[model samples]
Target chain A: MIAAPRKLPAPWVLRTFVVLILLLVWEIAGRHGSQLLFSPLSKVLTSGLQIFAEAEVLEALKTTAWILVVGFVLSVAIGLVLGLTVSMSRFTYQTFLPVLLLLYAIPQITVLPLFVLYFGSGPASKVAFGVSHGMFPIAVSVIAGVQGIKPLLVTSAISMGASRWQIFRRITLPYLTPSLFTGMRLASTATLLGVLLAELYVSAGGIGHLTRRFGENFQPDKLYALIAALSLMAILINETMRMLERRYSRWL
Target chain B: MSGASSAGQALTLRLSKSQKRLSLLVKIGVLVALLAIWHLVTVDEFVSPFFLPKPDEVLRVFFNIIVTGQAWPDLKVTLFEFALAGPIAVIAGGAVGFLISLTRYGTRAFEPIVSSVYAIPIIIFYPVSVMALGIGPESKIAHGALFGFFPMCLSTIQGFSRVDPLYIRLAHSTGASKSQLFWRIMLPAAAPTILTGVRLGLMLSFLAIIGGETIASLEGIGHRIVWYAEGMQTGNMFAYIVFVIMVAVLMNTALSFLEIRRGRQ
Candidate 1:
């Protein structure tokens, strides 16, 4: 028998090494680089407390988080209600989905000014925008989940004299759970985009205010630190949602 | 119950024509009701009218610009950003993705890294773009290209690398040249997925340009809205919002139409 070829090391090991090389290069380059360009990774690590210790930074972080939670909760509520209502009858679906599609098609960023104009540069506007972004995906996902039930199952349930509420609770709810979780994951992403985009646009307050301040101050180390915080938040949100989605989807 | 449902279905089929008309009427009714509510709420001052200008006033501003041909210059700047960003995103993203996907080893080495970076809303680097390119159309173009590149690259890598091994092996067995195999087998198989990436990239570019302009710009459609908003020209700002929405809608419809027509071929 031929001797087995040596297997390569795991992919993650390779990935880590690649990252280390890039970071080394970045640090080396930054040592000689212009002030506007970059900060060494060493500097970024050491400056973490400088970014975290600022009270205003903490407040902005809280504001962003609070808005995201409010928007996400509202999205779940509205998406379920609206999605169910629109899918109530074939007529309603035909009447509303095309219009919904039209609304969804438009780049929502176009309306940022209107949202800011209406809600002021407050968390209210940020929450509203996040809900707007988050709700559509949830609604779309719910509609898809509701539509996915095979006709025979519905027919069988009706034949067994199931009432509307029974039909929903026993049949529809379980079927929708996986998709709902999936929608939450997507909604989380969209909501983050919307809230962050609004914050960035406002630039008068919140996390965006800090970013603009850092950039203008030409403090690349602090700028990088603050951005790294935002990136960490984004990854945490996404990973949490992904985990929940995965857990619920095992039955599916 | 199944038979009754069949009868219900037959009934719907018979009523399809009238239902279609009824659906249109319902849709129109919904729009009318929404507008009426907007008008009444503002008229009643239930909420501050500052939050929502009158619908008629917004419409008037919308038409005045169209009739007077005032929206063209702003549209030109935004579209120019689009035209510049779109090619860079497509060509560079596609090439980078293809190169990374050329070997399984490369794919394993890079795909996760690229995807994680994409997930971070690297748009946070808008300041970096602004710093590098300054507050102008060039910045928007660069911002758009950078933001748009991720989706295109990710999808292209997915598309090319995931083609069936069976197809590749069959082509090889048939004495197919590398170019022949790529052209005849890989291209067709990957076309739909790659096109999906391209479409996403296109949309992202549009959004990024608008976003970059929104954050900071001297001119562009997004800037036009900010200009009016800052100046307290609410009516005109509302009109520009509607105009931009219409443009978005039209572009998407045109894109879908093109996609369908091309898909058939």
Candidate 2:
């Protein structure tokens, strides 16, 4: 006799259930726990909604968003150019790859204060920090992508009388797309971390200041709301990058 | 084909010796050039000394801090917090990951959820931690533990769940007991991936502790860097920054060595 098919909830349904249960626990804990330390989900939700109406918070968010975009774009451009240049010849790749890895290994937070000193406590410093954090992953990934291109493919293209430009555009570009996406996805997270770290470190005004204020003033609701918003933004950016990576990686 | 490949490999190996020397020379050349440029700009006053202190000054101050033991207290605080957070993250994350991987449905349902949460900048919750745990080592430990947890958990899940079922089946067929099966088959199979996760977790924990200190704490090496920066003592700040980088490099090097050795075993 054949066994009956097992019925199970979908992952999303289970996820929703998990979320609801968590919210319930949070609500109960917040109400019963220290009011000064924790805010209930209801209060946090209300405050989260209210923050959008605050002009100061909105302005700070816009500043952060603008800087994040600029930093990300700059990192991608620099990383791609540098990656291409170094990977052009095996000699250059051998000479420079270790340097890049060494620099990458250096815990960048140490130099963050130096960034602020040079760039000042402004968006410039944030962007610089973000670029520093984001670019290495891209450069490394790009190098790997290039190195992984089978020599046989290049030889065949050469035999077929494909010019350097055509060979690159046809064979290399498509092959590198997935790796580039992977790098970008990692870079996005790193960029966010760098920018946020800079922001949190010494912001005269912006989300950093607001976070400090909320924490110091015992405004747990507002603090939770602001964090939830930032977390949401991070989730959206990461998910978008992942989706793009998946799409491009399908060819592999 | 084998002969041709081996010959090619030998040729490449011979070429690599000279290539390695050339790379080292280039690396040294680059470092010297950067230092020269740094000295030139600062000495010529092309860049403000306040902004970019001379390499000599930074080096002098770095030695001063070490000699005077100015960094010891802050270093202790940072290390103490790391000590507490790193182990907690590894154990808790590993345990949870193992539990989740026990059932295929659990793995499918929860993996995405955990990863999605992981993608969120958990640093945004720093303020909440600061508020709840106060502006002390407790907050830093909590923050570091939270930051390290996701990687540890994800890697553990990936490691255990992906273990070859054939090995487990063979063990069972050989009359291996449950604990014996786990100890002899599953643990060895999953060791490398789990060790990698542990390495990542520990590194991130240390970094997060420093980051937390930079953000809000009154003590720790990160706070000292900020303190000097705010005071506009660029020389001392640069010194602390250099010291912190050295510590990080050392820690990461040690962890990588451990990972390699254990992975081989």
Candidate 3:
């Protein structure tokens, strides 16, 4: 029971070693394996630049980015409004909360086809899908944050003669910031998934179309490169949001 | 001023149980009203049938699909993919996690790599999968398994690594064999976290399978929705969408229940 604590090893050094070995193995396998089975890292890197030079790929990436930004902005605005409205009044909360939760619990991916049908396989569909996915997390989290405020604080503020508006501004809003940021981080990821899924489903324009083209043409190298680029974009967005969450959550 | 004060006091009175019941009723009422409005608008052509089919029409289509057995093959494909992917994810994740948890050094070396990768949305690799595996169920299964793998592995590692050393020490002192110690102590200690991982893995696999079908499948529930939508049969499309959502909800609920039940023991 009183066993001494185990000495922790150097994590980064071991990680680097493992990664290097894996990469080397992959490089070797790519050289020996069938072209269809694998593309060497060097070939992929060289052809990757060429794939990026394609105008359609560039345009598709821009369109995806635009949709992500616009949809996220709209989701945050709408989520904040709906979350606040529901949290403000017990009547509204009880009357609408269940419905909101039911909708949120539904697997939204199932409706991708319907979204495309209604929005005509355009940017509208992608943006709408993104907004739908992104809004729920923010709404749920914001409601939780608002409802979780310490009761004593509210009472004390009122006792001190703070106006309703002042109480909301000085207390509730600030209290909810950490949760709001956490929700936004989650929402951003969901939004990205929704928009990307919709875009991929449409397969008529944007990144999805390019991927489809590459897949059909058996351009594995190009496909891998393109996907890697998109993944990096997703990682960047996620990391940035996580940083913001960490920064704001410090107060808690 | 006295009357206003009295009114304020009266309004601040605690809610009765009946009021709580009434609020539930109101919530249901709002939902029903929303559906009613939907029905009315669609029936009246205020919204185009193509955009939003009537609820009755969707129900009729649902019945027809069920009666005609149109959904069976797609259901089989999706379920098969899910079945294959789910178990693969569990076993692979368990193995990797077990290996990582064997020593503090392994945990230090691999845990961060696994977790950081897990933090990113992994579905972005679907295109590469589709490219490698083609547009069939193979791609879907691969995509689903990959999506499910990260969470399962991470959770399993966390579970095993956090097992109390006190139990291990006691077992060792009691002349417990390695296999017996593992079965009695390690397995029981790690079961809850592993179960959580399995639940998450199953859910993600299901979602990824559906997403794969939507993206590029010749058949499956998702494909059926897209087919109906493209054919301007909005009613059937909506029905299929509802059916799929229901199935997902049921799957998630069942898994959660199972997890809770297991956790108690």
Candidate 4:
């Protein structure tokens, strides 16, 4: 399949072209198609700013953001603690790692109602659910980080008279930083999933409620606008995490 | 002194019989403690019984549903969506991914877009999906497939593009045909990574379908759980949740085992 190389458009140009074509198609379809089914990008963009003025939508966004932040912070804390604890000894690691993995594999969605039941159909349930979804990646990442260090390095560190605390601080902490950040990136994604899923499933209040209302009323413009806002939030969070990860790991 | 310290480190890690037993004890101890807490909390009414049904009540509900086959129709619906979605996602994703991987420039062009889109929940599309597909199995399948496709596509691209360059050079020097290089060298090399993607894609398909059903569907396992919850049949709801969790775990375990086994080959 070897052939002479041919000219290709710049990546960004191609990407922009692809996006533009899709938007053009969508606009055409929206014009000619059922109003019940589609909204053009222009309509969504115009209506998007107005959504921010609504107290209910603003409140939902605040609630969702708060839940995600609190849940993410707590998850990182718990994940680090559990990961460090389990990695303390080989026996502990061997014994408990599988158990932790099994728990991680169990889709947290199944227990969304259970969370709502236990914590009430409020922010607490959503936060708890987000924590559950978010914690595992960090925990697993930390575990891998700990276990990945060479035994020879540990032996040498001990030989040099590194105290348990000092060894952990000097050796493990530095090693874990990169993974911890990457795990945070992954955890952010999961946290968003858990919070959004709970919010959507219930539809009593918050972004989910507003979107459900919009859907029922066939307000496609508002629905698209809401989705776009949420997606922008997601992208910002992830991109920030990525930048943090890169900045930290630049030396490596 | 260094030797002695090294010896001590080795000793600390040694999994002696008593350590294994202690590990087992800790594992069982944790489970017993959790169950005891659940039992005590409900029995002592530390929490309202309305919210926290006793374990036996949950079990009874689970058993009764199974014996009466009440779960069958819901299970069937979920499974049908999964069946329709999973294969469609895999084949389509794999094909698209392979094409993207054909050139490094192509990968650079599209990979970022795929990954960035992947980070977004995309579940926001549910309301639109429900609207368009009318709250039927069609919406679930379509959304589930869409959800599953990205993971498969990402992994497939990773699998092909990340193949060792040295091997490709060797194959080329030996005058291997394009197809021969792909099938004989590339496929096997990429099989493990691709399998992982397929497994994840399959898992995601099931999860997406369940989530869709939970949100807006009239019937399915997820719908039934919501139905029970809304009706205040907490025990029945717990049963369905347990049933779904078991199904998910079993499939996940089986898929992992399949991956590990294939990896050996």
- Interface RMSD of every predicted model, in angstroms: 7.3, 6.5, 9.0, 6.5
- Model 1 regions more than 4 Å off: A1-6, B1-15, B39-50
Which candidate order results from sorting by DockQ in descending order?
4, 2, 3, 1
Could you tell which candidate, 2 or 3, scores higher by lDDT? 2
What is residue A27's positional error in candidate 4, in angstroms? 2.1
Q: Report the C-alpha displacement of residue B83, candidate 1, in angstroms.
A: 1.6
> Residue by residue across B77-179, what tens digits does model 3's lDDT show?
9999999999999889889999988777788789978876775667667777877787899999999999999989998999988889889989999999989
DockQ for each candidate?
A: 0.45, 0.48, 0.47, 0.48
User: Candidate 3: where is the Cα deviation over 4 Å?
Assistant: A1-9, B1-15, B162-186
In model 3, how large is the Cα lDDT of residue A87?
76
> What is the per-residue lDDT of model 4 for residues B1-265, given as tens digits with 9 covering 90 to 100?
0223433454566688898899899888888998899999998778776787888989998999889998999999999999999999999989999998887777777788778888989687788888788889999999999889999999999998888878888999999999899998888988898998999999998999998988888999988888888888887888899999999989988998998798668
C-alpha lDDT of all candidate models, in order: 0.82, 0.86, 0.83, 0.85
* lDDT (Cα, tens digit) per residue for candidate 2, span A1-252: 012237877767887898899999999998888889888999889765697799998998888889889999999999999888877777787678778888889999888888887898878999999999899878877877877777789999999999999988999889888888989998999988898888888757667667878888998888888888888888899999999999998978
Here the TM-score of candidate 3's chain B is 0.89
TM-score of each: 0.92, 0.94, 0.90, 0.93
Question: What's the true lDDT of residue B167 in model 3?
Answer: 92
Give lDDT: candidate 2, residue A50.
Answer: 95
* Residue pairs that clash (backbone atoms under 3 angstroms), model 3: none
| TM-score sort, best first | 2, 4, 1, 3
Residue range with the least summed lDDT across 10 consecutive positions in model 3 chain A: A1-10
Q: Candidate 1, residues A1-252: lDDT per residue as tens digits?
A: 011235866768888998899989978987788866678888888974477888888888888888889999999999988778877777777788778766778788889998988788878998999999999988877777776656688889999999999999988898888778888888888888888788888876777667766776687888788888788788778888878988987986
